[model samples]
Target: MPAAINPPVVLVLGASGLLGRAVHHTLLESLPHGVVVVGTGHSRARGLIPCDVTDETTLREFLAAQAPRVVVNCVAERRPDVVEKEDAKARVLNVRLVEILAEESARLGFYLLHISTDYVFDGTKPPYKPGDDPHPLNAYGEQKLASEKVLRGEDSGERVRPGQGSREEKQGGWDKVWTEVLYGPSADLAESSVTLLARDVLAPLRSSQKKVDDWAARYATHTEDVARVVTAMVDRALTGAGELRGTFHYSSKERSQDLSREEGGEQRPGQGGGRAYTKYSISVLIGEVLGRATKHLEPEASPPEGAPRPQDCELDISALQEALGEEATRSRALRDGLREVLQALAANRMPPPPSSAARLRLLLAGLSARQKSLALPGAFNGLVARAVAHAGFEATYVSGAGVAAGMGLPDVGLAGLEDMTRVIRDVSACSGLPLLADADTGGEGGEGGVRRVVMEYQRAGAAALHVEDQVFPKRCGHLEGKELVPADEFALKVQAAARARDEGQVAGEEGGGNGGLMICARTDARSVVGVEEVIERAKRYVDAGADMIFPEGLCSGDEFLRVSQALKGYNGVNGGEGPYLLANMTEFGKTPLLSVRRMGALGYHATIFPMTLFRWAMRGVLEALEELREGGRVSKTALREGRLLTRQETYELLGYTPGRVWEYPNANAYSRRKGTRRSDFVQEGKEVMEEEDENEASGYGEENPKKK
Candidate 1:
């Protein structure tokens, strides 16, 4: 059955921020249908409809404009010093904005999502939970706690009811209904710049007995994890399984240390009682949010007293773990992440590969199950992840087709390495699959070229990559229009890729250098030379240290069988330790799509899936764009549903608050967006140069379309 009608239109107030962007990305990929997500801000996005969160009039206008069913707020600033110094400004954003967004959501009968901070609790207890009382230490945390009280509070002082608390046709005020922080992400990497400086300066000196940089890692949230929570929430809401609301922690799922029990069940006296505040062992207000531990300073006999030694930051994040899922939990397991990332780089792969995972396993696991077997280095990307999820699949293919065809752009190296990296990042985000991507000509010519490309790819994440010895304007793997860079140069590139792949894996002091990029040397020699010489060049290429060989443009089954048998022997002097080879079988290309099981039966270990996602993505985007133009509003149907955002939704993501000058509409300001004067106005035009079409000027239905 289809999801019911009247799906909530989530309005995001601020759509641009680390967490906001991450959340938006998650929503786009995971949310269900019937969810309308609109956005509001100074800018617009593919799935976001912009609006101003601080402007009550504009907020209402947009609210009525989209008739939102939900409004999520992830915006906040709980910095104590910032708040104390600018309390008035801070309240506008952190406190006032929350009330405003909530009120609007309630008026429209939409679910309100407001993301809060961990700073709400003072350092009075250890392992504070959600139900614990909160006694904020500073202005920022206090304000955050205060806002929570407002949401949970009964009508009291300054309730601002219309006509003096006697309800009679109210215009705008507050609401009692709201959702709480369901999850959050790594906060250690950000907002703790100060903490990091100290650690960097303190830790090294302590190590050398020379001097230490004052710095320490903190327990904070990862934006990616936060996004997962948002998506999960949407999924639950769409499925009618979302009962968890109010204030829920959006942290990890690890079992945290139990809260310490003192006389007041707290160490500090000023802290209030019974608010369910989360308490870490020590002060959780270290440098970053998900820094992960409480810091301790290395005590030395008073530190030589010159420039005082820097202090370590004190922070923790175990409380967050108890609330997140396994995958979403923050792990210190950097090795696994690095390994998966390295494998992807070596394979030259992408996700949504050529053949389905099942087929790949059946036809292309390895080249011939007999004595002549094709060895495939581990693959990475979505293919492997999908195979694991679906089961029964063994071989992997990279999505070059998805990259090219999906963008509706030619795959002739037009999209730079960054484009490819972005695809791999998304594909690798969840799928722990090993993949081989199509790296045209090692991204240049020489081995140095290979090193540069492979190094970056490793950082971006890939199992392996295929660097075809092809010239400029390289055609599709199965197409005829292509040329090869000299075999020797290509061979050098392959070796370089091998080196880079290794370095990338052991990043950060352990790997000697920044090694860990992997490369699969590919050769189109088969297509150019007749069948026999193909083996000759393949041998020379393999001799030059190719991790895996991708011999493109092989014909029929007989041809595949022979090629598979040709390069069967010859390993480097390291005994049988030679590079593994793979097969490229793309449908509608020169090569026929061999089943993975069949390939495995033959001699191919892995299959390269290029251009699949690119094609599908292109078709979908083109269709969606055309529909939006015709309808005057973008279609949320084709978009990853449940993730569709509205204006209010954006605000939360951007950490929007009434204090943010960019947000509020002002009747008093002389230099505000809504004030008497304007700081800057967007230069909207057809082509950043062309004016709106003349047809748009004459109030045509296409331009303004009357309200139904």
Candidate 2:
């Protein structure tokens, strides 16, 4: 009788990580019946054979014991931050380990499928073919590129090639595969960016805002897709059907769409799955899948901090497609992949919407506990607010003047409740910072108007709103001819605003008082009446339930101090919490420009840089216009010199991801509902199409007149 033939052994190193686990599972499911698969991991807890690939003795011993036909090497420190922090250690695993594997493969004659990264490229120019010159930006990429060199024999001066023998005899050799931004099932969410985002970023968005990098373009590939490709290559190599050699790129391509029916015969890059995504866009997709509002997630348009990352290291996968066909190289859509991940994470439970009241409380706490005055820079629009947030301001100010100027109107109360509320909503949405909006004179409709303005601003998500004592059609507090209403009448309006805020608070809600909305009463009486009367009216406003006082148009630091002292003294006398004192440090204002520290030292809680950014922005616009008119065009050199916001910077500021759909956090619920209905409609349509096809095949519709 013929001796029993043993099955070929396939070894998977680093089988505990996101990619390793996937490749191991895929080989188990896809390989021919006689192929035996063995997975080894550094840790025994994951049920993988405890074998540290970094230990040359242990690895070689394991290899000799298994006598494997194929070795899928998935071990590497992939985190850019970790790799940067521990360069020497990472190099040992990333490069040295590969060198060992290559040597082992050449000797043992086992096919080695090594995993690489798209980070081998500098990412400046993308769709990088395998032959493209490598220029890694960070230590992680540098090490990955080094490992590839080792495999290609450039480092060792001995090209590692497949062993020449019979198909059955030459079961082991070496090849390299590159992939990008892998994400899929893992025991730990931190193992993959996609899972980390779902579990860490989107899940906790209710209490805190998160900033995700939206500048770097990434092709998020699912680990499962990569696993299938690895399995297929291994199967081919073992079966001797094909030879897998050279460096190959494997990435999840954005799905192609048929644009033949599209108007203008053109389709946007974001309309299909072939498009790259920024981290922000990925977060948006995750949010949609989780049914969570992404309003609390701000897109950082700039490159992320820590290790340097490539901007767009999109790998060109033509080699993989050519070798395996389109179906084999195809990847799951990002959303669909995320849905699977989210399901594994928490059964796809939706996180609660971010709380506006919580943001207001954050502002209040910041003002109350700040060692220095909280500087609130005025943001006229959402873009400006995003800039403010990026600048690291604790809170933002929606200046009435800034808003009015943006609308091409004068700051004479022409920007009414609707106007101010519009800006408030925009700034709140974009900045994700506590906002203090300017409500001039609380509109012209007296106490009722004041109440309406308060409610509207509160609903618009303003953490605080300040109503000045100046009459309707009010002049800029710093400008001349500013008139104040009667102290009693203005006090009534302040009382009405405060009451409206309190009434709007939801009962039984956490930190519910006034829904965390602060009503700051601004006394313009410093210019109209006197500093003494300014203090008097401020006291009256506070007594009428104002949460803060803005002493507008105070001419000197002495006056600011006096008003602040008076308010503090009044609070002492009243024996309860006193209203926060706010100082206006607007440029060219009657008030002297005081540093935030100086204001804090003088007992002020907050300071507003109203119109500061707006003024600077306007000056920039004028300069650009003048340069254009004089030179017939602005010089590219001038533009590149950081004199203007770059197109990429503008996109970042706007949180606009090119080649992706715009995600509105506020409309997430509607979008999810619509998506469900659309999916159902498509499924139903497919069913109908199937029925019609069956009838056609059965001749049911061809001659129904005989039955009739």
Candidate 3:
């Protein structure tokens, strides 16, 4: 029998960092529905928390109110020189904030699981195990190791010296003795993750006008892998509480750097003293957080796919495995770690793009100038959409057979409505132009088939859908082995599709509460029978109120020319007929890539490029993977040299920094001003009496108290 799946609420601190973000993604995917995973971080966390992490009073209140089963802290300074300089900054985070988290989380018997790194162990030992003693050479390593000691305490369940400050301060860091009541005051230290990151990373990148692309290419960590693991383990670890005390060293990959203090002089940490040092340290942390960490995840997997073996900082999981099982143990390997890092980074990478609402819409006009002209058959993707809106083509074609071939699936109408919707959604998101999606012989199911097809395509964000008069499992257009639906049934389906399209409105959250789908009734009747029969079918469809008429397979451009001439002369079908015409242009297929000017001349209203993005994405991944395989390790160095944008260059472009990254001569020092606000989360740890009434207030709305 399997272990019964029981997961509780897990609170993740710094839920926006490479590691913390990864954990958030992982947990969301692994846990069953209703398993709570509340995330917290400063407003700078992108959007996770509305306040700062250093505000102890609010941080405590927030935790106490949530009353989660477990608290996992993935927060850290991550910068060496900054911590090395003012040391207090590092202590405040690496050591102090953790103490605060543990004490606050303890309110509801929350057991804590925090991530510490191998930097704690100086490279003196090869593959340091859980028991290996640490002797850190850098400021980052030293502070983390020190913080671990502070978290563990003098002995489990006993009073220990404070993580920060002299004996006089009395309260700060995770140093609170577990048994003591936490409602106390002390002189507080103040520093926010935002400030640290700004001077170090954002400031510099902004200087370069926010050109981080170069910076990101170098130094990649698999944040995705971390997200998967934490997302999976948080609840399990939180299940059992009481007497749980210790630091969990997460970095388990092969070692880097030497134990000797003077090794790897890449950059002098405290170059111009403490102030300069702080800047340098913060800069590195910023790169780690912003650039690669924010990649889009899409959706995460369980023990997510493509895990790499032998990754960063090897973690000792013998105890965890013993306590849990082999599955958990196996997941602790390097590959698992890499997968987590990758997934997290990918998830985080998704840019907060613009969506919804209408605007003037930006367009590229030139040879792509919006000029009206002619269109050929076969418009299925990106090129088509571009042609429709900006290329000035009268109509673009979408072929049913082409759609199937693009997916690498059989064209025998095997592609379902859902599949079509997905592809169309992506195309629509990419293409702002009008679209004419293929509905291949109406649809798969039955009566009112055209209604079903039209409804779905409209919801899929399509401007139009084409329904052909063909039988079930209709063969590809322009291909043999095709059959036809009863002419009458086909006629009804076309009417339904047309009615669906003509309605023209968006649906409510509930299905079918808006303007109906736009329908383009297609006639396969032309090629099968004579021109007269096809013409008759077209007339009937028009009578049924089709938004447009698609007559498949005309022989040549002259035939098209003849039809357009005839339509102008005809009297029936919605007055003289010049319906929308589509031309599908696919790679290695029928039509070739045509310039917008040429497409306009051809009378094509639009074109589509469905496979362009997928092809590019796949190629990039494979090349990167191959490079990793051949080179032993993925290098952080950019393909081209020259400062690799150095955190500052990337920041400079944004024009959203404090003066400039290099202006202070040191990125880390608190040179700008005094009176800077402490992270809202840490305000609880401050002396209450000293605070003004306004200072004591918490959260976004001071007037509205948070509900417990």
Candidate 4:
């Protein structure tokens, strides 16, 4: 009988660290059963073999004994601050360890796969290729660069390197992989920069504000992704498909600041290449996931202290893609990866909140259920949006009239796309609820304008928006003298909006999913033409790809029922699928003030109280000013009796905890100085007043008998 053959050994160095553990596990899962995988670390934990690779004598002895066919070098002192503090000791592990490994690989005849960093580049010029000139800015980068030189035969004449020197000079078989900032499941928060920021820095400051660096841009890549790249290369080499012998780059496309070169150095607040998050932005997202307010978490525009970092070191992974194909080089999205880290940290106590896509799907589900007509109160500002969410409503609306009134403008199409989108962003961010915005007449530029509205509204976080058929400088839907665009012209605009929505979904733009941004066509034709004309135009709009129909200025519940019954029965271009119907229940409008139940009874999927909260809020403002003017003092009674929103209530509504130190002096113009407590003002208005019943004081609980 022939002697039993031993399996080819694959050794992993530094297998206890975040990236090392990922590589070890990936190799175990990816390699064939014939391969023997062994992982060694400085410490014996997680079943990793204990060996200090920095010591050349011990490393050589271990490698000789194992006689591994392939060796993956994951050993590095990754933290910049720690590397900066102990340069000599860090150099032993980061640079010298690789030198020894290269020499040993030449002797042992093993293929060496070495992991490097994006820090080798200065970061001023980005999307760095493997052949790009490196200008390391700090000690950590300098050491990693030195290691690369050692592997490339630039360090000494005697040392051998891959893809370089004469055949006689070439000794070791090797490949170098360059990667960027890494984060993944680890033993502790300190193991990764992302988790450290979230758990150590941001989580403890629930009531206080913390400033984070937003200047240095980074591509936060997952370690598991890098590990998979290593695994793929190993598999290819083992199968003789190809040799992994050249310098390659592997990094995530998720960037910190994805602004175009033309956008210049300064980034305006809330503007960037879509969904790219900076460190400050990452903190804000973590706060959102934790249900904490990041209002106080400010962005420091300057560079951070300790260890100089490159501005942007985004790696170009084309080489890896060419070698391993596109699927092997693909990266997980930043938010999705962060969610996994957070879930591990929280022990799965907190599930990720609904994404924009999920919220849009929820809205579509609600519309389809037909159990009740969704009550959508108009939110003119972010605070109002918060109140709407807190009131247990399914969703909210950004009414054109309400937004115009809030901006001190009339509702005759004076407010443009920017004005409506500004409020849409605020409402969506604050409420985290699906929003329906009013795009009045789709602005001034015709079909292009309609497309812009769809794209911008989707970016601004609106789940849906309605474009009206009324002409430019249009009157409110309830007002007289409103002129309608030609039915064909309006249908063209609707088609443009629908096409833009489809394009955005395909491009993976914000709020993109199967439902996408719902395009509702609002026909002001009820007043301009007739009820029959309204129904006919509704069918045309449905054919034009409007997801829903908004019949404006219907004078009675009967007209609403008539339109709903007609549209529901008519089979249009949408393959017999009936469009969701919306009814306007604006105050002082041509339509009667129909209750939610009554709207559902009339077969409408939704009913909008376009100016309800705005009207109520303005009335309170007027009454308060009048009382102050007549009495020469504000009503202490209102404050003491909780008739107005108290400071605590206001903070709670804004997702903030009160009694913390307020850092921004300009945040409250009423405050005398910086760091003033919120309770300081409440202490001044402590005079006792006659308190009303809880329902009356809080303006909740009992329903109004007059409405009934």
lDDT top scorer: 4
What C-alpha lDDT values do all the predictions have? Answer: 0.46, 0.71, 0.44, 0.73
Please give, for residues 1-708, the per-residue lDDT of candidate 3 as tens digits. Answer: 232233355667887664565566566456654355655554323224333566677677767645555676777776555666767756777877766765554434565666776565544344345667766666677666666665666424553433233332322223111000000011111132222222223121122232211110111224443444444355444343213234333322221111212344453221212121112222343334333222211212122112111112333545544543555423232223323322222222232211111000101011112333333234345433333333332223344555665677777888777777765554453333324577777775554565677766666655456777877767655565556566676767766665555554334311221223445666766557755666677666655656455555555555544444444323433222234444334454333455544544554434444344445545776777887898876566534544234565444322227532211111111111221222222232222222223422222121111111
**Candidate 1 least-lDDT 10 residues:** 699-708
User: Residue 516: error of model 4 in Å?
Assistant: 1.4
Per-residue lDDT of candidate 1, residues 1-708 (tens digit): 232134455555565544565565566446653344444443322123344565668666756655554555656664555677888988877887766665554455555556776566554454445666666656777777777775654335544321122322232222221112221221221223322322232121122332222231123334555666666555555566643355665442222122323565544321223222121211232212223223433223232332221121122333334444555434422222222322222231211111111122222212222222322222233333332223322223445545654466766777667777666654443333333555666676466666777765554445456777777667766667567677676667666766665554335311212112334567777777666766766777777766456677887777777876666545642123234557765557777777655675565655555544334445776776787789978656645574344676555443355533332111111111122222211111111122334322111111111110
lDDT of 4 by residue, 1-708 (tens): 232244567888987788887888788767875566777764313234557676688788878766677899998999999999999999999999988887777666778899999998887887789899999999999999999999888899988654333432343478899988788875345577776666423332346667887887757888889999999998877777876786999878764433422345663322235444568877766655545456767788898899999888877788889889988888887767876776564441211223353344444433334334777899998789878776656578999999899989999888878888788877776665677899988867887878878888877777788988987879988888999999999999999888888776334345443447888899988888899989989989988888789989898878988998788645542224378788888888788887888887777777888899999998999988898899988778877876688777887676664543322111111121222212211111232132334322121122221222
Span of ten consecutive residues with least summed lDDT in model 3: 177-186
Task: Name the lDDT value of residue 537 in candidate 3.
Answer: 72
Model 2, range 197-238, lDDT digits (tens) per residue?
A: 654333323566778887888778888899988988998888
Model 1 residue 274 lDDT? 21
How large is the C-alpha RMSD of every model relative to the true structure?
21.7, 23.4, 26.5, 23.9
Q: Between candidates 1 and 3, name the one with more favorable TM-score.
A: 1
**TM-score for each prediction?**
0.37, 0.48, 0.35, 0.47
Instruction: Give the poorly placed runs of model 4, Cα more than 4 Å off.
Output: 1-358, 505-508, 511-513, 569-577, 659-708
